[model samples]
Target: MLDHFENDMVVINDDANSDSVQTDDSSRLTTVENPTLITTTNHQVVKLQLNATSSSHTKCCVCRENLRDHAVKITFQDRDFIFLSRNIWIPEVARCCSGHLINNLLSKEAVDQNKPFSIRYQELSSSDVQLLLRKAQTLIEMARKDLVSMIQEILMMMNVVY
Candidate 1:
């Protein structure tokens, strides 16, 4: 798969171990024109596509899984205490996933003292997800390279021929 952050493509295969090469022009995002689906060895299908701008994807931010019910949409104002002009829309779908985890945190802080149900929910941005995915991809590549180097060194020490 192509590194979402960089133009180079790093292909990981179970049998091959490491197969990475640089390509200038490679499809990154899936659009109507170029809708290509690539399947990895792990049976996970990755579709190179752009995010739907109309509504947020129904996936949990904390755990990249299908969101459960009991989600409520809350508006969060980014400021010390007072209100700010900027408004961030935390959709119901994404809110529910994080609400469960943060509910107790807010309770421990005694948020009720200041305001009722003062659970602050931040807006989930696609860029943040992209950056995380990029970081994961880079780490995987580094690990794969390290593993290959370690194997080669072990074999050399044993006077084994490939």
Candidate 2:
């Protein structure tokens, strides 16, 4: 339960939790903060720092053409797939020519042609790390399921199914 105040501050009317909302006049946001949820937010906010130039780029990463308007940021799925499969890490902030990508992922030609700028360290928040791990697990599970289904099909072809 919550009790409202004149200044829009809220008081949690509970015996177990004695939390009070603070009113920020600047942002006009009232929040009941918890120490453990300092880094948590209603929406996903991933903080990443990579030693690569991502802004004010004249040349595209895939082709050596002067970028004017048709530039697109590489999608997360493409980055994760390329990094996991090829061990080449492309920063999330990196952009390339729109022609080189399909649905924000690198085209087949671009995947074969473009390479990483250089080896650099990338920082990710805890939630981002967890998301990456979950993605890897899901990919692995999908591959396992595909293998199992294929094996079952092969066994059926050999009249082994009950």
**lDDT (tens digit, per residue) of candidate 2 on 1-162:** 222222223333333353444655553344555433232222333444332433325677666567879878777787787666666676656777888977667888986666656646555555676788898898889999999999999999999973
Local error of candidate 1 at residue 94 (angstroms): 25
Model 1: worst 10 consecutive residues (lDDT sum)? 77-86
Native-vs-model 1 lDDT?
0.36
Displacement of the residue 7 alpha carbon in candidate 2, Å: 40
lDDT of each: 0.36, 0.62
* Candidate 1 ranges beyond 4 A from true positions: 1-31, 36-123
TM-scores of the models, in the given order? 0.28, 0.53
TM-score of 2: 0.53
Pick the TM-score winner.
2
